[model samples]
Target: MYYIAHRLFAAHDRALGALIARQLAKKAGPESVFLPFCDTDEEDLVAPVKGHRLFELDRERLQTLTGMIAVLHGPSLDDGVCMEIGYAAALNVPVVVVTTDFQTYSADEHSPHWAFPDPLIETIAHRVTRVDRLGAPQLADSPDRFTAFAARNQAQIETAAAMSVEAILELAANNCPAPAPARAEAGTVFLEPSPHIRCPEALLDTLHAAHRSVTIAIRHQAPDPFTAAHADWTTALRAEVLVADVSGPETPPGGAVLIGAAAALRRRIAAHLPTAVITHAHGREPNWRNLMIQYAVGTRVCDAHSLARWLAS
Candidate 1:
């Protein structure tokens, strides 16, 4: 029974309010609404746990209890919610959002904030009717349908819950210090020669010299990409290759084919390479000085940031 706080006070506030109660009641039943009350303020939230009631908690004070419960409504891009969501998300807490008319994406392109499920984005409304969003239509619309929806997307829920709260929070804290323009950690950086500036030119030479057996990893395996992109780099090396492409068949914004190609190539390379990469990510990652910290060299990259690497060559 994890308590939650809804942020929206107007418009879809009712929808979000109903959403919280309905999901909790349906998921863990009565006990789903967990509350350790020490004051009168606590009693007020109980009614909402039973029916379409609103629970009022001082958001500023209860942020400490992030491990116990989760957030229902947030500022989307505000500092506090950003920090809390980053924490709750990494901790894999039960995050139940309550923005009736939810905002899917941010307005500005350079710095944008996306909703949860950067995972569930695959299932949002297509038309975007609003700014930030996914276009996939949902099966359940009412608050009561929340639990069932959670059940269907249990895999997604698990991902959210399994995050290390402390690790993520630490990453957030570290973000305060600006990262350098280019810093390749010892013994794990590679870059293939590019027709254009592509990624880092030195990276390819470093990997080739370090490992007798090398692998090419990219996010895409398109015709001219993984194979073609590395044609020149791999030609001379006798290293075994493993192409790791994770790009989907979906279309990208701005119809930038090269951007998609770059994303694909970088992901594949990151998978098997000890190389830390920050290629431009397709979806919802904040940029730190024109680059996002994407280190996928280890199975998966952390979302601390995103990057746009050169791949023209």
Candidate 2:
């Protein structure tokens, strides 16, 4: 079962945290284990985190925790909780936010969720609630002040067919830790249209951003530079990498390997970002043109674009 952690930075928010925990327990393990780490005890807090263990946020054991939740409902968020959310996010464990007042301005979900919402629309910009205040604030007198988690942050999570289109589909909704919600918004860069659009320079930059691990599928085995650089980084940083090398294109034939890889990783942790590529290593250019392939990094290549567009996108 997946471990979904509930969050209550304040004693006042125990009820919401407990409620979120119960809902998440239903979607358990087929995806991941959600574990909510906290400081207070079950009795002192609003409610108990059933089916999971609770730990103090600043404790050493918290460092060993695989994940955390930044419950959006509370008089105010806790500083420790924010640190845990960001830490877990960097570790690639997945950080899903739970907030009623999600900063989704612009009359559309155009910018990063972390970015401040449009100033004109709602001044409650994406403050990221960094200074986790333990007490309630003078919430805006507007009806926006959430009484309970009337709407989960999931409701605000959006998906679009095209970048310009201002439409969104909610994958899931709740005031709990949602897996890579912000990261998923960054579209998969690999699924571009053209083959010659690759920028190895950019690829290295992306790879370098990987903190915990990177999953790479080298279509036509790209070149040694990408792999070598990644390998060196992984070794030095002690990061893990999962590479599904299409080395034997001669054996499996072109395009076949890519299709299979795409299907396999389709349900992976994420389906966005340019996670795969078809490099010149496939064969000689004049003799054998490189077959176009798409792979997702943080996003799934739902739409087909040229290699250049994929990178540029």
Candidate 3:
């Protein structure tokens, strides 16, 4: 049994959710049973008169699921979806989290922070698939925003749906084993600091002395330093290694400054430079920024001192 977990609180969400579920079901083969939360009529599970019963039914459904695909979007994880993911994890059901939004939120005076999908879900997901939000304009006054949005982004949406079905099939075939975690590589590291925070001078001196060519891409948010020395050091230089510092902005939205910068840098220097991201150690849950950076750069490191030591060695 394949389970589709997503938000259907709004009509727009439900429309898109139904389309995704349909595509998955069509591709998942006839023998595969699809249990989308939105299909209350087909699944014989309606929104309960009492909220507790809804969870009870959901738990029952999760136990019977062999594989699951979840849609993750917006700024945070929906509370109900988070609970469902936990349930699936406890049941050892393989889960694929499909992130449908990649565009950064427009920053304004009222909201300086970036919107990111919840790190917890990003961590727990057995596999993560991203669909770049093709340049679909937000239509505030459209009578059916979801339909309009789907029309505009049909190609990308279908691509994501295909990938979701493939992941579901793979999970079912594998009997729901957790995917192996990515291993971090050791090399000359590219250290990217969060917006506004400068790389420590001691770190820079050590990097220079260690024979590693380092390029520091300053955040657009920070005031450009005036000195020639600063200019020389901050200029983007090509190297065999790229290390991003993902320490700042506690909650950066999708397309966080470092993530965007690293992605651009990767594209520009990918033929020569392999990239790595350095982040502060948090709990085991993967940071959304870290995940994005990992997607851009092939390597990631959590311990700054350890990475520096490795560079020195």
Best by TM-score: 3
lDDT by residue for model 1 (87-136), tens: 23223233333222254443234433445322112111111112122223
Better of 1 and 3 by TM-score: 3
Compared with the true structure, what per-residue lDDT tens digits does model 3 show for residues 1-313?
6777776456666666677677777777534555444533423533323233444445456667787787767665443444456456534578887767874342344532332332324434678778776636655565687866766687677778788878877877877355432222333444544333554566566667767666554333333222321332224222334454444433222113223333333422111111333433222233333332334444344454545565544
**Ten-residue stretch with the least lDDT total in model 2:** 160-169
| Model 3: lDDT of residue 90 | 39
Clashing pairs in 3: 114-253, 115-253, 190-242, 190-243, 191-243, 192-244, 192-245
Ranking by TM-score: 3, 2, 1
On residues 1-313, what C-alpha lDDT tens digit does candidate 2 reach at each position?
A: 2223334334545555544444444443323333343332334343232212223223233334333444443332332333343333333333344445433322233422222121210111112222222233334453564632333232222110111011101212222453331222132322211222342444334433432233343322333333432332222122122221122221121112222222222322222223334333211221111111122222233222322233343
**CA lDDT, every model vs. true structure:** 0.29, 0.29, 0.50
Using lDDT as the measure, which candidate wins? 3
Error of model 1, residue 263, in angstroms: 34
Q: For model 1, state the Cα shift of residue 86 in Å.
A: 3.7
